[model samples]
Target: MKIVKVEEFDLRREVEYGSAEQNEAVRTIVSDVKKEGDAALLRYTEKFDGVCLEPAGLRVTQEELQAAYSQVEPSFVEAISAAAANIRAFHLRQKRNSWMDLQPDGSLLGQIIRPLKRVGVYVPGGKAAYPSSVLMNVIPAQVAGVPEIVMVTPPATGGKAGIDPYILVAAAEAGVHEIYRVGGAQAVAALAYGTDTIEPVDKICGPGNIYVALAKREVYGVVDIDSIAGPSEIAVLADDSADPAYVAADLLSQAEHDEMASAILVTPSEAFAKACQAEVERQLAELPRRDIARASIRDYGAVILVDSVEAGIGVINKLAPEHFELIVEEPMAYLGLIENAGAIFLGPYSSEPVGDYFAGPNHIIPTNGTARFSSPVDVDDFIKKSSLIYYSKEALLQNGATIVELARREGLEGHARAIEIRLLKEGKAGTNNDNQ
Candidate 1:
């Protein structure tokens, strides 16, 4: 890790739109799935995942969901159940009801909120299988009252059939019964446009590799996606009071995710910055994914020097990090200064992994600088809102002339006539038809 002045450090990477070859491949796969349906879906599954399967074996049976419980230990089930309860309880608070306001003229205006009819959650298999993510994606949609929730993962992970046992158990625990044995671009296409074995969903959620991200981008307009996630990142805003070892460990937690992941520290104390830099080097060697973490630290990790902790907050706002940690002596005092962060962890005990696993908040957050605009996934992601208006005769008669005047000023005669015709039918039109 390098130490530099705050002005000298620049860690932002260009947005990944994928290469032409990858984009072309995703386009071809999506087109094939749209045209050939299940046959194309199965072919790609075999080619990409090296798993061959018949059409009859596409969907995971209820027996498999039940059997998955036996493959995992009792402790695993108990832990996940507890985590699920916490996640459910947290998201339930975000649930909203439809509301209406009656006007004095007998008109009604309201917003109707409803969950998407169906949702598809894509859980990665192989080396990146995370049961924690299964709960993060599924529980929020369930809280939003989505009727049909389906899950799609690769057929085999580490050369084992029926996917990973932990993933199956997580899905079953999350109350998702519709599991499919397909993955990659083909699976994303199948979720967007229904195949013989699978049904189309209104939205898709969860994380995957670059190929899956490109696939999600391809099918975005046809079906909504959670977000095209980038590599994991962490930014620690700490002071001399913070322990260097804990800071270094927390930074490496995100760095191990991939070589592109970034780990950064911002502080006023140059001595504290140097201490953390040394601690990061010491800890990097012990990580099982040290090779990946080492590259991440060497390429993207840094300790930025600031005039004061207040100055550090300004730099962090510009960076708009995905995960932010405030390890200062008085963390709460600086909370209001933070304006851009996907998830804010205050104090030493609130580590990033806590939210990733047992914590109630959704771990699927905006990455890169996207935290400036977007947010972490919550109950709102799975629901849609429609504006409702019931205009009574009195209300329309009173406002119709003003509406026509505004419409006609914009050179939209059709809009003006729309209000005028109604006013005339209701016997409330003024003597001047144009004004009405």
Candidate 2:
């Protein structure tokens, strides 16, 4: 890991930055899926996943999910069920209610909050499996009262179309309406456009490979997306009290995700920064993904020795990290200073993975530097709001002239005439059009 004073300005961008090949590949997949629909999905599955699945077999069945529960250990199933309960408990607090306000003039204005008709959650399954992702993606939508929730994951090798038992169990526990054994760009396209097998969704959520991210970008107009997520990243703002080993281990946790992932430390203590660097080196030797972590740290990781804790907070807000960990002696003191993190973890006990799984917060957080504007996935993603208005003759008569004048000022004669015509037809205003 590189240790540099905060003044250094030559840090390389994270490795997960998109490349031409990734973009091109995503474009090709999206085009093929757009043109061919289910057939294209089958072809891609065979070409990329090495599995040939019929359209009917693409949708997972209740029997399959039940079998998955049987395949998984009782203890694992129980654990996923418990996690789902916690996730549901947390997101239930985010549910919104429709509200309306009536005015003295007999006009009513309000917003109607309703759950999406359907939603699709994409869970990555090939070499790596994330059962926790199933919980994070589905539970929130369920809490939002979405009528239908579907999930998709790539089939494993040997032409298996079954989800990981843990993932299936989690989905069942989270109340997912359906599951599909399709993944990658094709899965995203399937959800966006509605193929013979997969139904179109109002919104798509979850994280995937670079191809999935690009596919989401392509289909954004057809269906809503959470955000264009990038590689995972974590920025630790610490003081002298933070343990070097804990800091090093937490940084490596994100670094091991991919070579493009970033792990940064900003602190006022130069000696603490140096100790973290040494501890990272010692810990990297024992990790199974040491080579990937080492490359990530060498390329994108840094220890920034700032002048003060206040200055460290400034650097963190400028960076806008996806995951911000406060490992200081008095972590709560700086909580109000943080304004740009997707998820903030305070103190040594609240590690990133805790939020990723057992913790109730959604794990599908904004990545890169998008935390400056984007937010973590939550119940709000699966709901829509509609503005509603009601007006009585009395209300329209009272505001009619003002509305007409404003519309006429904007050169919209038709809009002005509509209001005037209504008033005149009701005999509430004169055809001569005099203000008196």
Candidate 3:
């Protein structure tokens, strides 16, 4: 990590996620899956994952899920059970009820909150097995009362041609049984368009590599996606009071995610900045993924010197990072200053990983600068809302002329006529033929 003045440092990266060739390749895959259905799905699975499968073999069987339990540690199952409980409790709080309000004129207005009929959650298995992600994604959908939740993952785990047992156990514990052995753009395509074996879903949630991110971007309108995720990143706003070792450890946590992952720090004290910078170098040598973390820190990480905490807040908002840590005096007092972070960790004890694994909150958050407008995956992502409006005869009569006037002003005669027909039948438009 490098230390520099805030004004002089460039925090943003100009890298493109998927190139034109990759996009065209993904487009071809999506199109082929849509056109040829199961055949294209099978071909791409064999091509990218190096695992060949027939249509019947795509879905994981009940026997396989049961056997998966025997292969993993007992402690893992206990941990998953505990995490799932926390996740379920948190998301259940977000569940909404269908509400209706009766008006004075005997009209009813309400919102019908209905869970999506079916949803697909893509859990990554290529780079690493994220059984924790299985809890984060599927638990919320289950809490939302979604009838059927389908899970898709890479066919291979660590270059081997079998599903990761941990992922299977997590999904089974999360109350999702319809698991599929496929990943990458092909999985996104299969979920979006539906092959002969897999049924289509209303929305897709979870994170993946650049290709998976691009695939989710490509298949957005065909199916609702959580977000078009960019590289993972973190921004820490610290002061002289912050522990340099703690700051360095937290920054490196996100850096090890990938080479493009960013881990930045902003502080008023130049001495603290230098101290953390040294700690980062010392700690980077200890990481198993040090090669990847070193590139991320060298290319993307920085420690910025600001005049005060107030100025640091400005820099933090401008970046709108995925994970933000406030390792300063009175961290809660500066909470209002932060307006654009996916997840806010206050003080040194509230480390980023606390939320990532054991914490109840969804770890699947908006990456890059998207926290400015988006949010973490919640119960709302698995549900659709339809506004309900009903008008009594008296209410319609009172508002009919105003609606017609606005409709006529827009030159939408068809719209005006539709309202006029109801008004005319109700004897409310007796003296007006303005539309005619």
In terms of lDDT, which candidate is strongest?
A: 1
Per-residue lDDT tens digits of candidate 2, residues 1-436?
7778877844335445368898888888888887888999999988888888888888888888888878889999778888888888999999999999998888899999999999999998877888899888888888889989889988886766656777777788777748888889989998998887787899998889888988999899899998888888999988888899999999999999988889999989989999999999999999999999999999889999889988989888888888999998788888999998999999998888888888899988887678889999999998999999999889888888888888777777778889999988887762333333
Between the candidate structures 2 and 3, which one is better when assessed by lDDT?
3
lDDT, candidate 1, 305-363, per-residue tens: 99988999898888899999999998999999999999999999998999888889999
lDDT of 2: 0.86
lDDT (Cα) of model 1? 0.91
The C-alpha TM-scores of every prediction are 0.97, 0.95, 0.97
Better of 2 and 3 by TM-score: 3
lDDT of each candidate versus the true structure: 0.91, 0.86, 0.89
Task: Summarize candidate 3's per-residue lDDT along 137-209 as a digit string, tens digits.
Answer: 8988889999999999998833355799999999999888999999988899899999889999999888888
Q: How large is the C-alpha RMSD of every model relative to the true structure?
A: 1.5, 2.4, 1.5
How would you order the candidates by TM-score, starting with the best? 1, 3, 2
Candidate 2 TM-score over all chains jointly: 0.95
**Candidate 2 has which clashing residue pairs, if any?**
15-260, 16-260
Question: Which ten-residue region of model 1 has the weakest summed lDDT?
Answer: 427-436
Candidate 1 off by > 4 Å: 157-160, 430-436
